[model samples]
Target chain A: MPTIIEKIFQMHTEDKVEAGNTIWLNIDLRTARDFAGAKVVKNLLKHYSSEYIEDATKTFFTFDCNAPANTIEYANNQQICREFARKNGIKVYDVGRGIGSHVVIEEGLAYPGITAVGTDSHFNILGSVGAFGQGMGDIDIAFVFKTGKTWFEVPETVKVNFIGTPSAPWSAKDLALLCVKELRRKVLGRAIEFYGEIVDELSLAGRITLASMVTEMGGIIGFIPPNREVINFYSKRSGKEIKPVYADDATYEKEIDIDVSNLEPLIALPPSPSNVKRVRDVHDIKVDSVFIGSCTNGRVEDMQAVAKILKGKKIAENITLKVVPATREVWREMMNGEIMKELFNAGAIISHSACAGCASGQIGMTGEGEVQVSTSNRNFKGKQGAGDTYLASPETAAASALTGYITGVDEI
Target chain B: MKVKGRVWKIEKDGKLMDDIDTDMIYHNKYLHITEQEEMAKYAFSNLEGWQDFPEKARKGDIIFAGENFGCGSSRQHAVDCFIALGINAIVAKSFGAIYKRNAINSGLAVLECNALDMAEVETGDEIEIDFETGEIKKNGICILKAKPMNKIQYAIYLAGNLFRYAEGI
Candidate 1:
């Protein structure tokens, strides 16, 4: 019996397949960001005519990675994307619209049982909705645009089962950081399927955060099978009848059990996402900035956590907190609710909806000799401009904002 | 594709660095530059290998790397920069998934040999990779055997790229 991931591959290829078998399957949704989309468009035009695009509506282009056109070079790329979108009849999410990878899910373009590919590696985030989402390079994406098919090797499945309930200060970010620590490179050439009661009870935001961080462990995708909650959410948002796919009992390559109750609010120190530490153990590392959003932790629930921590309070005078919503829908919801107001009242610098400061420090950049604790996925040196970055949960980022240093919710 | 070339390994204090990420392959500062021709100048600009590589590297030079090569953002620049430098192939212990796909789709030869030992390979070591035969030889002696590509991957490589392969079909 095949796992859920193996089932997905079998259904797509219409053949019995297992690990290490190469098969070419049709792609459902194809996406690209401004930086990569521009190149994909150029390559497509160079090879085939615009009419060669099998279905323009099936493709999406978004200007999110370097939103607001931080530099002239990026602006030029955005212009290229806008022109290509117009020329090819493809849908375009303009700057400040959304993160391309996350918006695809919210807009119902990615759903259960379908396969998706994007130009950015975090496309695996769509697995939260039970879709088989994988990231490919722009060249391969351009090829998909032409052929609507790509090949992949079936990977072994790693089953991670969460056993206990999670408490405050410990959310999906902590679980994801811990997963990165434990799995590490062991997930190479494999897929991670999350199961057990704890995962089913987790909120949609939590699931998305977990699904988005699989790449840190070198897994192709981190998937939560379409439980009732997932099916209900996607069916409501997409207006489609979503169905669940189940893996056979005792059908995984390896099984690991985790007790969520034993987990702590975790933080990944600088230079690597897997360099995790409990937030309580590290203290008084004075922070010059706090960026509280990215695809990893930019959902509405994260905002609510930030509001709960910073309401009726001001941030540390020495620290500048930047809050960036993941998508336009999230941005609007936060604006209408109390989250945005509370963040602004607390002196948090709110940026536009996009990967503004996460990837390249387009908006709230760090300074020389400065230290920042962000909720973004990567903390690689110079990942977000100068200085150092630490990855933490949204709650930890909020609590750290109150002080001018790294402090967990317990400390606050 | 068969590539025979001298191998170059990036090392620090005679130690092979594992998990050489894409940020080191091509820095983020050069990410905005879209011209493939302009990318070689910045290849390995931050990594310990060959700061003057753009001026010195030949068309068929192979890069030997440790585990998780190109393990970072799914930037095609990481693969494209090497293509621009005329790097014929890269043999690593492993690859970040996206980088491997990008390399194959762009017609750059890459292989995975779990037995790849950087300690045994030195700079300017004459190495030959026959993707068709799944063999890698160092100094005319067979040192490792790479995982052979599947038919579809070889088809793409044979046609020079995915786009061209699709056109031929």
Candidate 2:
């Protein structure tokens, strides 16, 4: 009778808990990133001087927001993190390792029924693989580092069923955008459990693409019960059998059903990720740049989709197409395949695996008066840059790059 | 449990603004600064029309916003900037999940008033909030009702922060 999140919480706590009850739960994995890693360490030292952390083995520092230290400030911050991790005997996934959340997944640090907390707002992406992930502030993360636990209120869960399959040119990003549009502000401060045949058919990458955008909907976390593909991935990595967790016979606060059959490639306009519109309605908007990577859509399958569209085709002149793989593992996989060559031949500037445009000073930051079509989540003003950003799928970004305009995949 | 302060209504076109994201409250470009005093100057630096907030805000000022205030990013700077500016409390129709938790854990007061949009409150108006009774009074007159902090949030607020609360426990 417990939802996935509730069940995960029960596993971590000694007493039974329900919605609206705030209780402390033991943490399995605690992580911080370059963006706030130094602050976390500073806070930890400020409050608890030189005290041994609760569990150094479960703690990690990942540097991906500004990989390779673009600015002096970032370099100093990364140095602080490294120094602290060295002294504390904690792991540090340094620069070029890609986004911290994706690294957690690739390294198999998080699994089903586990609780992970980090300094990233999108750490809830772990929910795609059926883990309970929450992003907290530096102060809270520091406390978690010191105590190996944090207090959380169990949120009521809403069940969302995705019925019917989306055809070609309508990728996982499109489905995610449609979900954001339909469920905007409705799932605020609540957990969401994704269901239906469409969810079952989605690959692990596809599931990640959908679960990552749950933040835009103001959701606490969106869980897609670990599918067979997710279980197999973790089992092979750990060399142990993985058990799947499901929300069997669980009660929900609300239920929403979305039919993906009629959905088309969609784009989120500037200033808001929920400001969604069909690609056909606002086609041919001249784009200055196209960013084809981020935690949201930087998997190998996303790269393959872009490669298939841009093969033997040159991108439009004056259009800078920036491609970034999600992690070193994804980058290595692309290098061994033809995806790298296809994107390179199409004149895309393939940079190191990192959060390119999502974070400041990265490769894909747009200048003032520039228009960028990005695969990353969140196009909020002053986020990617002063320029306006439209969120789209990999196929749409590749197609738009070819024509120097916001063109849908169907048109190309 | 009573807080009285001048109001700073976050609005546009004569209506309360919704979805005021963290980027608008404290832009990412200023994320490097960890000091509370340095962060104060950049509050609302990226928001359109509110870029001068840091200049106008005074100590003990309260902010009134529409639904989903502090919507995007889990950046604690958004909450820290307001605290740096000496804001006493924030009353909104709703708030982002992470933003709400960040505020409570950081010892900042946040109240939810569903009738805030309909309340007759304006910038510079002096209002008093009674957390014990969920009463909101403007100029000594009861004007609206707000949802007070929950048990955990009030406990954290009393203890200064999550760290101090844990120490006592």
Best by DockQ: 2
TM-score of chain B, candidates 1 onward in order: 0.91, 0.97
Q: How do the predictions measure up, each by TM-score?
A: 0.96, 0.99
lDDT of 1 by residue, B1-169 (tens): 6678878875666655677777777877777787899898888776654568778788889888778888878889888998988898888889888888888888888888777773366888888888987788866777788887778788888898888887777
lDDT of 1 by residue, A1-412 (tens): 7887787877788655878787787888888888677788778888885545778878888778888887898888888878877877988888888888888888877888888898878888987877888888888888887777788888889998887776654788999999989888788868888988878877888989999899888889988977777788788888987776777783788987877777889999988899999888897799889998888999989999999999999999878898989988998999898988999999988888888766673566676678998998987766787678899998899888898889989887
CA lDDT scores, all candidates in order: 0.83, 0.90
For candidate 2, give the DockQ: 0.81
Model 1: colliding residue pairs:
none
lDDT by residue for model 2 over A1-412, one digit each (tens)?
8888888899899856799898889899999999888889888888986756888899999888888888899899999999988888999999988889999988888888799999888999998999989999898899999998888988999999888876655888998999999998899999999998888888999999999999998899999988788999998875656776788899899899988878899999998999999998995599999999998999999999999999999999999999999999999999999999999999999989888788884795789999999999999998999899999999999999998989998887
